[model samples]
Structure formats: structure tokens, C-alpha cells
Target: MGKVTGFLEFERLEEGYEPVEQRLKSYKEFVIGLTPAEAKIQGARCMDCGTPFCNNGCPVNNIIPDFNDLVYKQDWQNAITVLHSTNNFPEFTGRICPAPCEAACVINVNGDAVGIKSIEHAIIDKAWAEGWVQPQPAAVKTGKKVAIVGGGPAGLAAAQQLARAGHDVTVFEKNDKVGGLLRYGIPDFKMDKSHIDRRMAQLAAEGVVFRTNVVVGEWPQGSKVTNWAKEQVSAESLKAEFDAIVLTGGSEQSRDLPVPGRDLAGIHFAMELLPQQNRVNHGGQVENAISATGKHVIVIGGGDTGSDCVGTSNRHGALSVTQFEVMPQPPVEENRPLTWPYWPMKLRTSSSHEEGCVREFAISTKEFIGENGKVTGLKTVRVEFKDGKLVEVPGSEQDYKADLVLLAMGFVNPVASVLESFGVSKDARGNAKATTEAEGGYKTNVAKVFTAGDMRRGQSLVVWAIREGRQAARAVDEFLMGATSLPR
Candidate 1:
């Protein structure tokens, strides 16, 4: 509403990226955020739509119009204030979130959507540069203690909220550092690790305690979920010590392809290769680390994780990189008239895909072919939908050479052992069973225990994790004090 007809006058401008040639040389953030002027123009493009579908479209229900207006008026401080009100970590979402909000933008029905993510990026970066982001420690202690298991976005969000509500909050992270998947699963080229470290400092200053390298429950033996815990704390001890416990662990159990020769040495889960690269980037040594150097790499799955593998493999100087998806390729553009104000399915080309990748859709791997216990290639078949079921195409069998295979089909659920240790029940999908209602929501069948984020809702977006964390904090506060002032 800052400019009534501004939407008609402005065109969308996207954030820039460093040249692929220069960026592949190092593992650092390559995104060049929108300048203040460009952000203002982008903000001005926000139409004064009555419904503001973008707000509902965003997982955290951010006040999109308000922030857009603030940015349009050059009110940098208020823009960030509005942003942080809904999102605890805009930097993360601004960098990695797919911007479903933009898909639901009213302007996107016919024209390009306003660059909301870029504006958010500008707002948060400016806020930090101007020292608007600082510690907001609670003035009085509530005389209550809360334990948050997992230091990913959800756990961190809950810890910050509970700490600000005057409760003693401690976050237990199995890895040597916080930022569960963000630190290891996501490549540093998309978002630098410094963003997470900066937020950690702010949380610590706000009286949130972090216990890194500490697993609060048992880890399954020989599981490749990237545990770096140096110490262990029993679930019973947490229940005895803390007033409430929030399970916000990530969905770490990756879905596997059980075809023939899956036991090949060079074939690994995306997690196995990704986390090792991240550790190496952070100056930590990993023994026998998986590398793509001079190898023909095949990444299975077509999601963000697979795209990440593409980027990392390119950075590793792989001889060639190919990705596979069983599903048919989506249309290059969605029919906005039929899917307006909702997320629509369409072809998505990530920056990693733009770098260099041979994407094969409607293709399924039949078997992994190997030599001497090492992957050498894979047999595949083109698939087609027949009578509502996927069926292999006749005479479509083929083989492709590959030296390494990375399975990135996404995670299935949280580690079952941790839930078992807490005596928490799970949904049919293996995620912790919990509701999101206002009354007794987020509470598990077990006493004084709650679950949220990927642990409760299965693998999801960072924005959804933040939303669940904030709501779970409210639920816990209500359970501990019989009432809560925190927002749901």
C-alpha cells in the first residue's frame, strides 16, 4: 500500500550470483543480495491485494505486506522487526527456502511475483550491519528449566523463545556444533556457516545454553546419520531434571535404494558424502572421506539434496555429474489460473543445476553394477504411468557408466532409537506422533515431552521448523506455568 499503482510500474528483479567459474573454486556463499534500491523497487511491486495470500502461503505466516511496505518506505529497522516477529532465522530461509510465498503472490497470477525473499535477505543483512539485531535477555527468571534435544533450526528457535520467556533453556546437539542439517547437509556454497555462528552468538547472549557433542538418547549402532557426540545423557535424566523436554531432532534416516549391488563401496548416502565435505571445509579431518574427484558421479533423486550433490560434485572436480528422478519432468511453467494462491508443481532449476548436471527424469535405477566391490555403473529403465501406477517401459533398459553413486532420495524419519529412548510414540510415517491444536498440542503420549519440526512432522522446510518450534515453545510454557504469553 506504500504505492498504490507501484506493482503495475515495476518488474521483478532477482538476487544475483557470483560467476560459476569463480564460485566453484571455494565453498562459500555466492549469492549477491539485492541492494537497498533494488529491494525498495521489489518491495514497491507488492500489490495491495485484499487477501494477502503470501502471508498464508508462508509456512511461518510472516507479515508480508507489512514488511514489503516498510522496505518500500526505506524503514529498514521496522522491516526486520516484522520479519523476525514470524521467523527466528530469516537468514536461513532467505537463502535456502524455495519461496513458496512468491508462488502464492497475487501478482504472480499473470506477472512476476515481487522479490520477497530478496527483500528479506536485504532487511536481515542490513539489520545485522546496523546492529539492530542484539541480545534480548529476559529481565526475570521464571524458575523453570527446559531441555531442547537437537540444535537444528527448530530446537534453536524453541530454545531462544523459552529462554526469552524467562526459563532456563539448554539445547543438546549430537554433532560437535549446532545447525543440524544446515551445518552439514546443505553445501556451504549456498549459505556460509558464519550465518549460523552469528545466530548462535545471539542465542547464547540471550541466555540460551548450548551443549554440543552431547547426545540425549541412544544412537543406533553403525547408523550413518552423522553423529559426533562425545558424551551421552539418558532420556530419563532429562525428564528428571528439566520441567519440559522438546524433541526437535531432524529426520536423519535417509531413504535407501535396495537394488542389487547397493553394498558397493563407492555407493553412499548423500549424508555420508555431504557431512564429510562440510567438516573438511571447517578444517576438521575426516578419514577416508568420499570424494568425486575425477569420477563419474550419479546422484539419485531430484530434490534439493540431489541438487546439493550436483554442486558439491562439481566443486570436487568430478569428471561428470548426472542426476536421476523416477517421476516424469514437470512442466516448465505452471498453470497459474488453476493453481493460484497455492504452491504449484513445475520444473525447478537450482543454482547447482545451472552450474552443470545431466538431469534424467522418468528414469529408475534397476541395479548398481560394480567391479571389485566398487560401483562402476548402474542399469536403468525408463518408466511411464499406466492406469495410475508407474510401469517400466518395454525395451527401455539402458546402462550408464558411473564411478560413484550418491543416494539423495530425502530422509524418511528421525532416528527410531531416540524416540524409543524417550518412550515417545510415532506416527505411521515414523515421525513422532503429536498434534498442533491449541489445547495439549505438541505433547506426546509420554509425560512432560513434546515434539515438533521434522521429528514430529517429518522432513520439511526451515520455515515450517521455525513455526513448529515457536508453537511448541508456547505449548511447553503453558504446560509448565498453566498459561503462556508467548505467541502460538
Candidate 2:
């Protein structure tokens, strides 16, 4: 511990944000990262807890205390070194991850947790500014080829690791760019795309090949999953050409609300609207793009996706924006005594929610009311829990005006066709069937095929995806060379 009693002396300092009024005008990152002094102070707050649960709490098992100590000691280079040892992209997680590590911090049991995410953000940004982040090309070439399907976090992580392990790595991305969700799914205001671009350059320099606009498997026609792929490579060809294949595609199949009038126009999945906006932001033209301008927008789903819809709608100058959640609202604060060292269910307000949104909890849409094949409003019923099941409250039916309806209820599973093309078996949840066991982990029933991230574990956090990708890379390396030096 750099400062034994620093936790008792310092209060938590949150990262700042640009004014909502100014930020709503553009799609750019608005977060103000911590200065070096502030980050050092934050690092000093790390208590001398015997066991660092934050390490386990983090999906990638980052050595939190070491980084914190390094930061506290003003060893900026070593701080980033410790951060990169566990996380391939601390910038990505620092921006978007919910920081379950902070929730599990010992200081959080009674006081505010150490600002670990902010410190990480400072470290990475500083590292990049100081040119500490550079290519780490392998010392020796293994002369083995590996194909990573999907250029999202997991696939990118795997590609970087496998490339650094001296294997020829090629990442196939269906979109026109490498970052899958990071490029299209998340709004630029939340995380700028430049971060992804810089990392891609580093990966390329490290001997990883990125094949953009290339789909390695079938993409379902008429699917809302964003695809700008100009070339399609068969799974059989990849198996024949590459020594091993890792499927890290995201769970693109969005969960749908199959109520009445689902066929109405102007009602779309969050993916349909979000990806289009991102493309537009990237200076790409989209035909008949969904917009919220001057419309009453209703976003169904109370998760991060729904919050993003709220922010985007506000940016589009919508007449009004409302969000709906079927589940009851959680408590504003969790009971730390009971929920310490674990993620707790509590009311989470995202920056998007802070911008502007009318959040309605415990409400379920009964039917979509429309006029001339266009959504006009929706019928809803307030719900309550009864006998361990959700039941609509009697006489609680209501109607709300809505011109644009976005379903942001989250994704269900990966596109089934891609897995089918690879002859990979699927679990009950429709995710690729793969284990995380120490032996033969991430290996599918199919020969020389591995799965990880959302494709194998279902839709999850970016940190989780990175963890799975790193482990899957180790698994593939072991399978190919009968042993691996890469960390699990």
C-alpha cells in the first residue's frame, strides 16, 4: 500500500463530464479524464485489504492493488504495464464497463470505493500520449495460421495475443470497419471511435491482419444485424486454410416483443437505429435511416441500450423520449453490508439517462397501436409480482403517444446461421457450446474450432469478452503447439 491511511483521508472523485447542453450537439466523447495528480490521489485511496476481491471482481482479473500502488507512487509507466497485463483495452473498459471491481472494493463496504476506472483511464491515456503503447511483435514466427471470425473485442483480443505468440492471425469483420459493437453499437458521445482505430493500428503493426467487410460465414438476409460485408468466405475454406478458427461474433439476435402491431413501420430494433446513426457519424450514408426528429420516441427496455436510445433521441431533437421497463425499479442504493464484494441490483442511472428521459418501470407494453402501418402509440399495463410471477395490475391500462418506437431489450443469442455454417453445436441458450475448463476449454465439438465472448458465453460486458478472448487464444495455442506460454 502506497499510503496506509490514505483511504481514510481522501474522498472519492468521479470523472467529470461536459455540460449536457453543449455535449448534446455533437457525437463526441464528453468524459473529462482525471489529471495525474487526481489519479494519484485516487490510487492512494486503495486500502491495505489482505485479499484484493477487486481482482476477482474484474472479469479480466486485473491486478488492481498493484496498479493502484504504482499510480500512487507516481510510476505512470508501471501503472499502464500492470493494467495492460490483464486488460488488452483498458480504455474500452475504462469508458464503458460498469466497474464491478469498484462494487467489490473493501473501501466500498462502508465508504466510497477507490476510483479505479478513472485511474485506469488516466493511465491508458497517459501511456498513449507518452508513446508507451506500441507494437509488441513476436520474437519468432511459429509459421502457424489462425483465423478469428468477428472483429469485436473478443476477436481482436484473440488476434493480438495469437499474433504476438508468433502465429499468423487474420480477423474477419462483417462490417466495413474492424470494431464491431464498439464502432456501431455504442454512441460516439459515450466512447469515440478513434480509440478503436488507434488499437487497430497497433494490432496491425504486431503482425495481426484485419480483413474488414469480410464475413467468414453466412449472414441471414433481412436480419437487422448490421452488415457491410462485401466478401463472404465459407467456414469450410477457413478450416482448410487456417490451423485453427475462433468464433467471437457478438450475440446479434435481439430479443423481440411479439405483441400486436409488431409489423408496424417506424418500430425498429435498437440495433437498426443505433448502427445507422453510428454509420452516419462515421460519414457513411444510410438510405431511409431511422430518425427521432420531431417524433414522440418510446424506447422499450431499461438497460444501457435503452438509455443510449434516450440520449440519441434527445440528440435528434425529438419531441419527447420515454423508456419502459417491465421489471420493478430497484432501490436507489444497495445494502452494502449484505451485498459487499459482489455486484448488487440497484437503480443505475447512465449518462444518457441524466441527459433526458422519462423512465417508466413496472410497465409492460400490451400492444402497439398504429395508424396507416406506422406506429402512433402503445397500450400498456402496469405489472406487479404475484405468486412469484409478473401479473398485470387490474384497471391499470394506459396509452402513450409514440411516433418512433425502438426496442432495446437486449440481444438473445448470436446469429444461428454463422454457427450452423461452422458445424458448431449450440447450447440451450443458442450460444456456441463451449466450456471454460482448464483442459480442452473453449473448444467446440467441431474439430479445430473454438468459441468465446458473446458467441460462447452469450451477450456480456466488454471486459468479459476480453477475458474470454485471451483464454481462448491460449487454448488454441495449446491445441496447435501442444503447449502455450500465453497467459490464461
Per model, how many backbone clashes are there? 0, 0
Q: Which residue pairs collide, candidate 2?
A: none
Question: Per-residue lDDT of 1-488 in model 2, one digit per residue for the tens?
Answer: 89999999999999999999999999889999999999999999998999999998999999999999999999999999999998999999999999999999999998899998999899999999999999999999999999999999999999999999999999988888989899999999989999999999999999999898777777678754344657789999999999999999999989999999999999999998888899999899999989899999999999989988999999999999999999999999999999989999999999888888889999999999999889999999999999999999999999999999999999999999999999999999999999999899999999999999999999899999999999999999999999999998
lDDT of 1 by residue, 48-165 (tens): 7999999999999999999999999999998999999989999999999999999999999998999989988999999999999999999999999999999999999999999999
My TM-score estimates for the predictions, one after another, are 0.99, 0.99
Q: The CA-based lDDT of model 1 is what? A: 0.93
The total number of steric clashes, by the backbone 3 Å criterion, in model 2 comes to 0
User: What is the Cα root-mean-square deviation between model 2 and the actual structure?
Assistant: 1.0
| Candidate 1 deviant stretches above 4 angstroms | 224-227
**lDDT accuracy of residue 206 in candidate 1:** 94
**Model 1 TM-score?**
0.99
What lDDT does the true structure give each of the candidates?
A: 0.93, 0.94
